[model samples]
Target: MSSKRRVASGAVLAALAVAQGVLAAPGAAAEPDTAEAAPARIHEIQGTTRLSPLEGDRVRVDAVVTATRTFGSSRGFWIQDPRPDDDPRTSEGLFVFTGRTTPALTQGDVVTVEGTVAEYYPGDPATTAAQSTTELVKAHWTVTARGARVPEALALGPGTVPDALTASPGGSIEHAPLRPDEYALDFWEAHEGELVSVIDARLVSRSTDYNELYVTTKPQQNPSARGGTVYLGYDRPNTGILKIESLIPFSQRPFPKADTGDTLTGVTSGPVEYDSYGGYTLMASVLGEVKGNGLEREVTRAQLRGELAVATYNVENLSAVDGEEKFAALAEGVVSNLASPDILTLEEIQDDNGPKGAGDGVTSADETLRRFTEAIEAAGGPRYEWRQIDPQDGADGGQPGGNIRMGFLFNPERVRFVDREGVDATTPVAVERDRRGARLSVSPGRIDPQHPAWEDSRKPLVGEFVFKGRTVFVVANHFASKGGDQPVHGRFQPPARTSEQQRVQQATVVRDFVDDLLAVDRRANVVVAGDLNDFPFSPTLRELTRGGTLRSLMDTLPESERYSYVYEGNSQVLDHVLVSRGPRRVSYDVVHINAEFADQASDHDPQIVRFVPR
Candidate 1:
């Protein structure tokens, strides 16, 4: 949610206590400066490239403080030069990181300070890669004057930012000179650390728990059906989206609560700064009043009597320790919104003591299922009997100790689960044929669990169920996440999806499973569903739907309505329900329950496909 304005702890420090008069900033202000020079302008310090040419050299600048954070992890002040420069390539504003000193400064306070030019990255390079923020660290300060003339903030609008989201696709643009007129990243880079404004701001996504929200200056740039940005392709990533991190103290004004389609009906002024979350962000000091758009969560119509309603939901690391309120809200979403699916495949089911149980050698999730099913029954929904294969404790790569795995919950009255011989976590589930047609070697088993693609990831849980005397082969999946992927607005122009190939490998594994089932019986009633954490247009999806064996329900909907998850400001698909050609008539929906709301039971929206198996 944050660009992580607060810095790392292993910084150089020759200063005093971290919190003397203000809160300790993210970087514990460690670097000390001994070099001093004549007054230098801000633009000269900010070169055309991402890294400043003057970095590591001590220089002074006379500028007015545009904003101040005397408290919190980013306790420092932002200053911009009043004099205008002809070159649009260099920025006139700068951020002074107050390491240990709580410099008493106010907005519009003129100051001349000497400091070392340093490029700071919020995260460790050994684990995560993040963009660097140019800062004037380790300083000697002098108050030049108070209440000086501050430059008018640059107005950012649809016309100002480039329509092109990037200049290079999957290539580094760090050395590229500023091309402000041609690219969005370049435009923001030219105005880095400078005050900017957005009028009639629309909050595209829900305000995060950290009080951070994404706003768009261009609302018409590939707008989604639900009044949000649409991420159509790797090239067209909705360049209008810009993140906002409030600098205003929470005590002064709590960040306004807002969801998708809500508008901040005035000017939102803030300094443009770079962070790793989603690149350039509006470090908003002035916020507008939020106007409600009356956007509500969507509901999918319940399946007909002849239809077998199957759904997939990621319960976001659900465990027995979760609060009753959370369980009840989730149950309500299923009952009222989803109208209670017949067979639900749940992902991220943790153990009895939540994630901690894995470390404590307690891996059973019987209690977690008990609480969830009871909550569903309490909410006036059907009593769903559950099935799951517990993974090796602490083997899955989710939370440190959370051994999350995929599970199933089926309504006994509506459908019957076929319980055959099962295999452990490392064993595989193979397809076999008998006189009664294709059948699983073991019912409710995992597909190729020992494959390298399943290493440190959840294996695909394949379940066989009978609805109206016909067998339905459903494979529920929670593939490798998109964690290691670079930010869309990152230094790599198109941004690298290092986590993508793993998903592709996982998708290929699942695709082969579906193909094998269809090979035995061409008209196999197979459905592949779950949090396959990638976009609908991604290679992962293409692989899953390859060879015409399985068809993605995502292709059935209009482009505007094909989203199941919202990222930053873009409404995109990260969850999907795919089926074989066996079902002639199929109705599918990416239900809107949690992603668009601020108070969500889960971060993901549960999706369902209704069809009658032939």
Candidate 2:
């Protein structure tokens, strides 16, 4: 007889009938010989959130099957005790791994399982350092009954969830369950691997590449004016957010494209587990209806009278390979959305051949810029002129192949480039003053090109332009990226910001140069803009504006409205426009085009500011 038939008779058969909660077979009321023979509760096998105390020990548990995954590397079913334990820290649910074999059981069916408890790590156990999940391995089970009751899912949200996942100074998870009610990491640690639900939660960020959505039950702290959350400071905590992972098992394409402020109703049920990539996530088995509203494309603001408009945009490594479609969309955004600004500071402009040619050490970007300018004109914009200095091969760090650099695009009809002698990739420009005011010695030159801070980074491109008979000195920068910095959700507590030191040095060099320009002419019309790759409150920004010679235009807007980039769920400011004392009462705005949408043309939203030169 098969294992299924052998377990479906005598005492096992009677117990299976009684587990149904409806009918009682003969001799179903008979008790076991001793209390030790009775099955253990599910919570006992899952003592704490981190690890089970009874791992590797043989035990028997009686639980109702809640969910099952029949195909996959980790094929398994979740079983939960109908009657939960008194301690909230202990989870009443446990996963039973059956490998390739399908267990002879159905949802809501009561069964008695005998197995050895083990802690399983998803990835390689040797290298990756993360918490392990408790499971019942090499298990055999007999159906105790059918139609058993399933435990109600515990609702998780604010007040019930903690504020932040890691402690400050050192980003690490607390293991002692201290302040479990106040910290999200602690709160989630207490309820690991338990059946959970999030009802009527609103999406806080767009769906990720892995088809995950971040949602919150209450309004997120430090909410941006454009309907996203902001990272206040290093000390401030961000709590009350949950990651919804893998919406339903075996369902093709579970996640739907959603924007911030969209509502998700219905009882979204799942098992809470620690995901290596996403921190604590609810591997959901069921998702409710997604209501998408309150999201629309933002319109361009009208240009101010007598004020020259200057814009900064990171095109996300645009090259000739981006093809005509992307270039057209980008042109539409520049012409229609940016109102054909007089001067445009651009970053991430690739070499002429894009990534492919960049690998062969080709440095000319003339073809790339020409194609983009043509596209802009075709989209009904001004015939613009461009200027830039190609970096030494492999000196500027970015994607290994794509040699990215900073450049400028100005409407020649609106502004004139003030050219001077002796400007090249290696030569540094200096601030000079005539009877009129401060001007660049070299119209299109680099600032401190040989500075150690710019060793492997894109050198700052300084250009001198005259708008309506007034000279405006513009500095285009693409500072060191935060490539090596540890993720805020990673294992390290207060993840290390390794790239900050280099950015600080870069900012200092630029700040000193700006000071020199101001000293020559305190009222110099200087507009410094591009992807600074740092936050407004970061030490890097403070170093740049230490003497108050330059002020961030973002500071002029409401704190909630100052953002140009979004990562995870935090809307942050990586690009900025800082003006010297000359440009007064500048009107600045972060145009809502990209960063918030999945189909966005670029990863960053362009920023536009208009000011009348003094």
Candidate 3:
């Protein structure tokens, strides 16, 4: 057997990794008679079962336990199946299914799971990998009750009550505690294409900034349906500011008949459980039951203020284009939603060349820039004025024609733009290439040689806005890319080529710039705003607040009202307005507007802050 195969086999019998070492709390483990013990040592099994299985066929099995995931009522993990050294199918692996009975098994929990050998034909790796490919390329084995079964352990936060041991179903079952996050990560990847069930799952009340869901394996299903904290979302048509009521969990739920630990089983999909702003939770399954409870009202726009605030939103791929109509509509929407706010910072608005940046048939990058100026002027209350980076054709780590840019618009009647400077910190290519001993190039598009100096340039648009006889230094910037395949998502490219390191370097450059600005102007009432590509706790952002150079506006606000963007159901605070060292002359706040306003238009929300210049 190859070295890799041997390693794979070793993983099957290896002990599970510790999760903060929290063992079964006070008699939480299952009884000795009910538990199944793993074989002292398991046998090795490998090869693709391209053909149908021989009736009653039994095969010895040993493979590395890649991960254990939970969705609905099922718990499962993946194992790399060994194949011939030269076989194109060598990359194949198998998923071992388990029942969802909490003190539920966790990620990296290596148990000897055995079942009848099954065969499944190969299909699109992406599709079949999640389906039943294992049935065709069968390697069936059922684990015996010889492996040590850790006694059932009670959970700390939300306790559980083990139900009566119903008929042991057909197959034997066993379990152990596992790390929640690791379990969620592995489960989503392994069963990403299958069906699953969940029970007694409660909806997490808070909004995930990015609209993503996060669950805590078994933890999310404990106690009763109402006690389990799970984030919820749905697949629907039409985008922009999806209402919280549209999500399934908020509108409906099941009763509390079955407790959290009761075993529920179903086909599994991905993202068994995960962590987020609220906590962790488990995904639901096909056969899962929700105790019928009337609808619950969790989030409502009535919770928002009617005026005087910045509303941050993602203008999905707001590219530099010819028609300023789209920009005009967006400006119109902002004006309608906010109705007030002396200043507004926008992220992802394309403005490649100052206000004249152009692309393809587009005349300039600031098409929206122009539209915004016009729209505000048309609105008539407070005339608008704007400023943006000069897209000097990629002069300073700037995009071609300054395609997608970040800038702000001020209500001239309310405030005035005093002076400003850009914060460009992209390290030069020569410096990076010299450090790595090789030339660096990204697949999406290489840095332009003609615009050499552009690589190290990224400046936060720091504008001095005068309001009520006080000056507020507003630093607006958009951070590095998220690097995914979807254009609606942050920029995506290969790791080495479109490396995060480059983005990190860019962040460091900005941090230094902010620090210097603070040093020179001690009394400056600085407020940093814009879409920072990274999350709040991300290391780069941590540095910005390390020495108290900046204070997060969200930190001073209530939780429910903090988020500025929603991704996949998860509400996150990506767009921010940070304050600097000085008296609080101006207060920062997210307008807390309805997300439906931005679902289809853009991927970001606009953020506004009110300042009474000191």
Residue range 145-260, candidate 3, lDDT tens digits: 12332211111122221111111222211111111122221222122212223333333222233333222233433212232221221111011111111112322443213221
Instruction: List where candidate 2 sits over 4 angstroms from the true fold.
Output: 1-62, 68-77, 94-147, 164-175, 247-254
Clashes of each: 7, 13, 123
Best by TM-score: 1
How far residue 199's Cα lies from its native spot in candidate 3, in Å, is: 5.4
Tens digits of per-residue lDDT, candidate 1, 1-614, equal 00112111221121111222233222223565666565688888888877788888888776677887666766677888766477788888889998656667777666666788888777773344465677798875655455555667777777878888657744677778887878778778778888888888888898887777888889888787887887788757688898888888789898888888898788888888887876789998898888989888888898899999999998898999999998999899888888899999999998888866557877788999999999999999999999888888877778767788899999999999988875677778889998868988887898888888988899899989999999999899999898888887777656678898999999999999888888899988999999999988899999988888788898888888878778878888888999999985899988888998888999998999999998
Candidate 3 lDDT for residue 91: 27
Which has the higher lDDT value, candidate number 1 or candidate number 2?
A: 1
- lDDT at residue 65 of model 1 (Cα atoms): 79
- What TM-score do all the candidates reach, one by one? 0.93, 0.85, 0.49
The per-model lDDT (C-alpha) reads: 0.81, 0.76, 0.39
Cα lDDT tens digits, model 2, 1-614, are 00000112243334434542243221111121222233567778777545677877777776677766655566667787655655666677788877766555667767776677888876665544455678887776666576655666777765667565655535344244433555566566656666788988877777766677777755757777656777667766456567887635536645677777677778788777776665678777778667886676565675666787889999998987788988888898899888888899999999887778645878878888999999999999999999998887778888767789998999898889888978877889998878887888887999998999998899999999888888889999999999777666554567778899999999999999999999988888899999999999899899988989799888787877877887766778899999998996688888978877767778898998889987
Query: What ordering of candidates by lDDT runs from best to worst?
Result: 1, 2, 3
Deviation in Å, model 2, residue 117 alpha carbon = 5.6
